[model samples]
Target: MESSPQVYVKAPPPPETLGRPFELMDHHGQEVTNASYSGKWLLIFFGFAGCREACPTGLVSMGAALDALGGEAGQVQPLFVDVSMEEPDITGLAQFVSNFHPSLVGLIGTRAQTFATVRDFKIRREYAMANYSTKETGPRINHTAYLYLVDPDGVTRAYFDHTLEPERMALTVRLHMKRRRTSP
Candidate 1:
């Protein structure tokens, strides 16, 4: 009997419908919509101010990824959307964002707007009373920690897990940019 060689075929991925339109206020108190950042790519992460672990880790990684991008970093706008139900003032949001990248913008919206954005992003979030809860210390928010990459044309190009390395993240973004540039 004679043996035949086998071939493998891969199918294209389904189109993503991950992100949606949002209207929020920046840390600077400026109103912004999804279309506000029309000419630049958006790197967005959703987390709360009270998140002590995952949020900082994700933000740091995101900052490092932007740094790794070097000149290409200017074309990307990094955003940290506050998903907490509690209202944090502009000063606090400004301080929090300053701790991350210089260009990282913190977004906060009304409860309804935040809820809509969270739902649109399909983020799973919950609030749990902390073990060391005090009058000042509120319930901690637990939410999904995925990073979203949105292209200039307001399309979600890709998303990355929290654990991905900064260098790898930058490389992935670079690849996506290259593909977009070369495509029709």
Candidate 2:
């Protein structure tokens, strides 16, 4: 008796609805919306400046990835969206973002605006009581750490786990950029 060969099937891609329009203020206090980034790819991460580990790790990875991209980095914009409930302090935000890549932009908005953007991005965030805190230090927030890659048209093309290496992340971004150029 002869055995039949098994065939493998590729799975369908996920729906492209993870990205949506948003209006937020940049670290410089300038208002910006999703449309503000038209014609350029966006690498967006959601976290607060106060996050002790994950936020810094993700931002450093993003900065390194940008560096790896070299000239191509100009076509990509890196964004850090604050998830804290408190109103944004532009000075502090500017100072915080200065520590990372010079090109990285930090965004913040009213609580309602932040919530809407977080919901649109399908981010999961929760607040946990800190063992010790002051009026300035609110409860710690735990949130999803995936780095989202959005196309120039404001569509989410892919996402990378926070733990992924910067080199790999740069390669993945390059691959996506190539595909975008080839696709109609």
Candidate 3:
């Protein structure tokens, strides 16, 4: 028996997340809870900063999509979570994350903060490269490259798997917002 290689996926036409709750942080180091997004849909990506590719690419596409959404995209809030716990200090991750997507914020606190947030979302991360960690010193993390879309009500509505086409992702998100607008 051998361990399976970790893989990352782009937004893969995830189901609709019309009503899921999520409590995450904003780029401004503010406390952004699920309640904070009570009236808007959310596009959330849980990834690390040291990521060589997927992290930046995903956020970049996501940002572009939001920008493309124009006024409609205002209803959507995109988020990024740093799964690294090697150190309480996330200066590296923060700096790295912000560089890609200025609006894409990174979260950091204690091991408990990471655990509590990740656990609630049912997200998991395995440190493969052990060179540095927010919780320790050096460690590469193994995390799924899936994005979770939560509804305004703070409920799990859909999941965009890895390898999701950018146009499709942006369209899907836009569609969700359009549907929300029509629904009473």
Candidate 4:
């Protein structure tokens, strides 16, 4: 028997490597497209309502980061994309994100719509086949954790992982905003 060489790879390229377009409804039932964010910066994250660890913490850190920016926050828009399979409507998305930040906009759509966004964003997600509610723990859906910064031109400029601090995040956002302002 012959052996073949195997290669190990991680996730897809960083989200900033691509500028995919997306269209989804906000919590208020308003349709928001890539163009809607034109002329402003967009901070986007994909997570579900039932996420107990990374999602909520990321949202909190984002809100704190924006707060740290003070007036500069107005130059950016924070969007929490609810990619949870459990939430099929805008109401659930709204209620989920409301607990974190007042200004954070929660986005939701049909399963197909959400799946489309997930695919475009290159977000990795997995569904557990076993029902954990019957056990000591609850059901779990795994997803990627990354905070993306999109420029006014609908281009992704940066992405942050779990180790990024709020202060650093805010500073990076300000620098990007400044660069955008200086550019033609």
Candidate 5:
């Protein structure tokens, strides 16, 4: 099911929260951060690897759109930021992300740290299946998909939904790049 635009959460504007930076492991278990992504446009999204529908389809659309971007996509980075507690370490998250978009990088961390980052980005998730943890009530994690465009300066300037039209997403990214280049 699709969510109303208004019901969707919005990430804070660029540089809004320098916040507590977490050391998330990438696909290779290499260290990465918001700072490490500087100097390139970032298409940062929040969702889990196990999400059966929303996450996979959304990413497929994103990758196809970026591929259509041709060489311009070289300036863009498609990032998979995970908040799932199933991942025990960075390597796990890295492997999970690599399974989809080979070029896509995955970032994973402690629940507290991951949740904090998600909160900063205004990402939202919901419990789906029975609780996997004995202490928790439910099992699987079903997330609300959100797409965030973080500029080279580390500012989140554009936002869209999980089911955002591919053509529109492409147009939006192009327009953003154009504006940034022409700006004083």
Candidate 6:
């Protein structure tokens, strides 16, 4: 008798990060940490309040994506962490983040703390200052732009680049949630 062909299966991808600890202050002067968000999904983004285009776009898209999730929105929390040397004060940063999404939590810290968190998350960032003698525009910042999707356990489940649309983002998040529910 002829034997049936062997079947192959692919395993699920592992988390990008096992989870990194960080301590930051919210816009409200409240302390926040990786442990603070335990038992809840986290949609984290690193950007600055001074950013004009990319930051606004990412934040708006994040709000739209969360809205698209409907009732499931409550299951995930959005966080905006400012890593700029020109980081705004707590009040300003809070206002900036809230302007994008009322539910979005804004975080800020000392230069050292911000750098440490950036290193922990493996995010790339640099200050772009224009020469004072030149006619170029004022200084700005360059940094990695990605939306990190972290599971309730704090492990990074996946990441979405700047090119992903809001609708697709919502779908992607839903798929992750489904996978987690079915996994052993």
Full-model lDDT for every candidate:
0.86, 0.88, 0.67, 0.81, 0.72, 0.82
Best by TM-score: 2
Ranking by lDDT: 2, 1, 6, 4, 5, 3
Tens digits of per-residue lDDT for model 5, 54-118: 67777877787687777788888988877676545565565557666557887777677677887
Tens digits of per-residue lDDT for model 3 on 1-184?
A: 9999989877633344222343445445666666776686777777776776566667777777777777777777777777766564456766766675555656654567667767766676887755665653345677767677677766656667646776778788777766767999
Better of 1 and 4 by lDDT: 1
- Candidate 5 shows a clash count of 6
Taking the tens digit of each residue's C-alpha lDDT, what string does model 4 give over 1-184? Answer: 9999898887767656654788888889999887887777888888877677788889988998899999888878899988775546677677888898688998887788888888877888886676653421345667888889998888888888745899999999899888887988
The digit string of per-residue lDDT tens for model 2 on 32-109 reads 998898899999999887776788889999999999999999999999999886878888788878889999999999
The sequence of per-residue lDDT tens digits that candidate 1 reaches over residues 23-109 is: 999999999998999889999999886566788889999999999999999999999999986775778778888999999999999
RMSD of each: 6.6, 5.9, 6.4, 3.4, 6.7, 8.2
Q: What TM-score does candidate 6 get on C-alpha atoms?
A: 0.84
Give the worst 10-residue stretch by lDDT in candidate 1. Answer: 129-138
Q: Number of clashing pairs, model 6?
A: 0
Q: Number of the top candidate by lDDT? A: 2
> Who is ahead in lDDT, 1 or 2?
2
Clashes per prediction? 0, 0, 34, 0, 6, 0
Return the TM-score for each candidate structure.
0.87, 0.88, 0.74, 0.85, 0.79, 0.84
